[model samples]
Target: MHYKQLSQQIFKKSSYLCVGLDSALDKIPSHLLKEKDPIFEFNKQIIDATIDFAVAYKPNIAFYEALGPSGWETLQKTIDYLPKDVFTIADAKRGDIGNTSQMYAKAFFESLNFDSVTVAPYMGSDSVKPFLTFEEKWVILLALTSNEGAQDFQFEELQNGKPLYEKVIEQSQNWGSHENMMYVIGATRNEQFAHIRQLIPKHFLLVPGVGAQGGSLKEISEIGLNKDGGLLVNSSRGIIYASSEKDFAKAAAQEARVLQEEMKVYLDQL
Candidate 1:
């Protein structure tokens, strides 16, 4: 989807919620184990329940890769089942040499048909540029992440006096316009949003760490939002696995609705 269409959907729905389909085999309800394809079954129900309350869905690639071939099949089936109107993301933090990166881009952007893929920029420009070739697709490069270990590298100050993550956003902005590129700015790093906003005010931010990770929705929306509602706050375990019983999908829907409702209030104030 294009940035204009994405931003319009955000305001149309009065939401910027991005539900994470990080489905774990061991974590899914036991009843689903009896199904031929348990992972896909679980994901289908979750998608059905929460589709209206969210504008995007991010499926963390690790969850599928862990299951081997069956897991991969389930992942593709889940991707096919998603509504086209809602943005889809393959949360694969992939980046390598230019040629290798091209293959990764083709796999996610062409084969699986994801609207975007998460990318790591440690390898520099050549590694990141391949993914930008696709029109209407996005490369959500990692910036300030929510994980504790992120502090080890991302916050390290350079001789120039700026944190490494800040330099990433600044340099990457030149590679692709805000229309085709974005950054992964964790909701847990809410304190830095003021500075982050100054660096890339118009670019979209794919924000994780909001629900189960303990990041505050109000805190992020307050500081991170631009005039276009440039944020897609993701909730994975908190929404998808809200219950482990037969009513899991219903519970998931309720959790999503609560978030979407809170987003509505935020949009109202905008």
Candidate 2:
């Protein structure tokens, strides 16, 4: 999906919510295990329940990769089952040399047909630029993340006193336009949103670490929103694993609705 279409969806749905399918096998309800592909079944139900309120769906690749070949098949099926109008993200933070990155792009954009993929920019321009070559496929580069360990490098001040993540955002703008590139700014890093927004005023941000991770939706929404509603706040375990029983889908829908309602309030202010 292009930026304009995504923006329109946010307006049409009154939401900037991206439901994260970080569906782990061990955590899903045991009843689903009876199905030949429990993961896909779980995802299908979640999508069905939340699709009306959510504008995007992100499937974190690690959860499926751990399940091996069958996991991949399940992932493919889940992608195929998703509504085309809702954006899809392969939350595979892939980054490699130019040649390998191209293959990763092809796999997600051409084969699986994801609208975007999370990418690491630690390898610099060549690693990230390859993913930007595809039309309408986004490269969500990691910036200030929510993980505790982000303090190790992302916060480190350079000789010029700029934080590492700011440098990442500043330098990367040249690689791809806001239309095709986004930054992954974790919701836990809400305090940084003001400064981060100034750095890339129009680019979309794929935010995670809300809900279960304890990031405040109000704080992030207050500081992070742009005129276009440039945010895709994601909730994973908090929504998908809301219940481990038969009420799982309903519980997920409830959680998503809560977020979407909050998002609508923010959108209305715009």
Candidate 3:
């Protein structure tokens, strides 16, 4: 889907929320284990509950990859079940050489039919350019992340006196425009959000680290939002696993609604 459509969804739903489908089998409710495909079963229910509030859904690739062939089948079923109007992201963090990157792009964009895929930029331009070739697909490049190890390399100052993560954003803008590219700016790094906003004001930011990760939604929403509502704040454990009981889907909806209501208030002020 195009960025224009995504922006419209945000305003239409009064939310910029992106529900992360890090649906690990071990973490899911015990009741779902009775189903032949527990992972897909859990994801279907979660999607049904959160669809109204979320503009996007990100399925963490690792969760599906771990189960091998059966896992891939389950992932496919979950993808097929999702509503086409909602944006889909393969949280794959995939990036390789140009030719290999092309294969990855095809696998996610053509085969699985995801709207976007998260990519790592350490391999540089040639590695990432292949993914940009697809029409209406997106490459969400990693910039500043929420993990604790992010302080190790992301903050290392470059010769230009800017941090490495900032340089990643600056150099990558030449690769793909605001239309086809986004930066993964961690909600945990909200202090740098204003500066990052100045760097790429119009590009959408796929923000993680809210809720379970302890990132303040209010501060990041204030710092990261552009006139187009350029943020897709993701919540994984906080929403999907809100309850361990049979009412998990209902609990997830409540969590998503709380965030959506807060987002509407913020958007109104914006």
Candidate 4:
């Protein structure tokens, strides 16, 4: 989807919520295991329940990849089953040499048909450029992440006294504009949003540290929002696995609605 269309969807839906479908098989209700394709079955019901409240759905590829070939099949089915208007993300965090990155881009954007894919920018511009070559598709380059390990490298001070994450955002803006590229700014890094906005005011940010990770929705919205509602706050365990019982989907919907309502207030304020 084009950036304008995505912005319209966020406003029209009164939400900037991205439901993370990190459907860990081991954590799903045991009753689902008896189904033909357990992972997809779980995802389908969750999508059905929460589609209205979410503008995007992100399935972490690692969860599906761990299941091997069957996992890949489940991932395909899950993508196919999602509502057409909602943005789809392949949280694959892929980055490699230019030639290999092109193949990876083809696999996710062309073959799987995801609207966007998470990318690791540690490999620099060449590694990230191939993904941007596709029309309208997005490259959500990892910037300041929520993980504790992010402190090791992303926070390291560089030549100009700016941390590495700040440098990543500054340099990446030259490769692609806000229209086709976004940065992954974890919600846990809420304090950094003000500075980040100064560095790249127009680009979208795919934030993924709310709810289960303890990132405050109110804090993120207060500091991170831009003129175009440039934030996609993702919640995984808090929504999808809200309840592991037979009514899991219903529970997921309830949780999503609550976030959407909160986002509605934030949008209105903007």
Candidate 5:
């Protein structure tokens, strides 16, 4: 989807929520195991329940890749099941040499038809620029993440005295504009939102680590929202795994609604 369309969904649904489908066979409800495709079954229900409150659905590619061929089929089915208007993301974190990155882009944007894909910019401009060639498709570059090892390098001061992530975001703006590019700013890194926004105010941010990872939604929403509603706060386990029984879908809806309502209050203030 285009940025304008995504922005319209944010207001239409009163949400900037992005539901993550990190569905794993081992973790899903046992009852779903009896189904023909357990992982997709789990994801379908999650999408159905949270569709009212979410503008995007992100399926972490690793979970599906681990399942091998069948896993890939399941991922295709999940993508096909999503509503046409909602933004679809392949959380693939893929970035390689120019040619390889082109393949990755084709796989997600052409084959699977995802609207966006998460990318690691460590490979530099050549690795990322290929993904930007696709019209209206997005490359959500990894900037300041919330992982435990983020401090090991993201905070490393560069020659210019800016942290590595700051440098990454600053330099990357040249490769693509806010229209086709976005940064992944984890919700746990709320302290840096103000500074990061200064670096790229109009660009969208795909933020994870909100609920289960203990990131404060209030702090993220307060500091991260732009005039176009440039934030997609994702919650994976907290919502999808809300229950392990037959009530899983219903429980997921309740969790998503709570976050959507909170987001509405913040968007209202905007």
Candidate 6:
């Protein structure tokens, strides 16, 4: 989907919630295991329950990749089942040389038809640029992440006195416009939002680390939002795995609604 359409969806629904479908087979309710293609069944129900409250859905690629070939089939089916208007992200942090990156882009954008894919920029411009070549598709480059190890590299200060992540943001901006590119700014790094906002005020940020990770929705929303509602705050285990029983879908929907209501408050103030 185009950035304009995504922005419209955010306001139209009064939400910027992006539900993460990190549906692990081991974590799903045992009852679903009786069904044919249990993984897809679980995802379908989750999408049905939360689609109204979410503007996007991110399927963590690792979850399906671990399941092997059948896992890939399940992932494809899940992608096909999603609503076209709701943005889709292949949460596959892929980055390689130019030739390989082009194949990754084609796999997600052309084959699976995801609206965007998460990418790592550690390899520099050539590794990220191939993903930007597709029309209306997005490359969500990882920036200041929520993980504890982020301090090992992303926070390292350079001789120029800026953190490595800040430089990643400054340099990667030239690879693609805000219309076709975004950065993965984890919600756990809420304190950095103010400075990051100044660096790229207009680009959308695919934020993780909310809910289960204990990142405050209020704190990130306060500093991370732009005039266009430039944030896609994602909740994975907190929403999808809210219950391990038959009420899983309903529980997921409830959690999503809570976030959506909170998002509406921020949107109204904006």
| Root-mean-square deviation of candidate 1 | 0.8
Poorest lDDT segment (10 consecutive residues) of candidate 5 = 190-199
- TM-score for all predictions? 0.98, 0.99, 0.99, 0.98, 0.99, 0.99
Residue 157 accuracy (lDDT) in model 4: 96
How far residue 9's Cα lies from its native spot in candidate 1, in Å, is 1.1
lDDT of 6 by residue, 152-241 (tens): 999999999999999999999789999999999988897788899988999999999987677999999999898999999999999999
Evaluate residue 30 in candidate 1 and report its C-alpha lDDT on the 0 to 100 scale: 96
Model 5 misplacement above 4 A: none
Instruction: Write one digit per residue (lDDT tens) for candidate 1, span 1-270.
Output: 999899999998888999999998799999999999998999999999998899999999999999998888888999999988898999999999999999999999998999999999999999999999998999999999999999999999999999999999989978998998989998899789889988899999999999778899999998888889999999999999999999999999999999999999888888
Candidate 4 per-residue C-alpha lDDT over 86-105 given as tens digits, one digit per residue, 9 for 90 to 100:
89999999999999999999
lDDT tens readout by residue for model 5, 1-270:
888999999999999999999999999999999999999889999999999999999999999999999999999999999999999999999999999999999999999999999999889999999999999899999999989899999999998899999989988989999999999998889789899988888999999999778899999999999889999999999999999999999999999999999999999999
Model 1 residue 71 lDDT score: 84
At residue 130, candidate 2 shows an lDDT of 91
Model 3, span 1-270: residue lDDT tens: 998898888999999999999998789999999999999999999999999999999999999999999999988998899998899999999999999999999999999999999999899999999999999999999999999999999999999899999999999989999999999999999789999999898999999999778899999998988888999999999999999999999999999999999999889888
The residue-by-residue lDDT of candidate 2 on 1-270, one tens digit each, is: 989999999999999999999988799999998999999999999999999899999999999999999999999999999988999999999999999999999999999999999999899999999999998899999999989999999999999999999999999989999999999998889778889988888999989888777789888888888888899999888899999999999999999999999999989998
**How much is 195 displaced in model 1, in angstroms?**
0.8
Residue 205 miss distance in model 4 (angstroms): 0.5
Query: Any runs in candidate 6 off by more than 4 Å, and if so which?
Result: none
Off by over 4 Å in 3: none
**C-alpha positional error of residue 87 in candidate 4 after TM-score superposition, expressed in Å:** 0.8
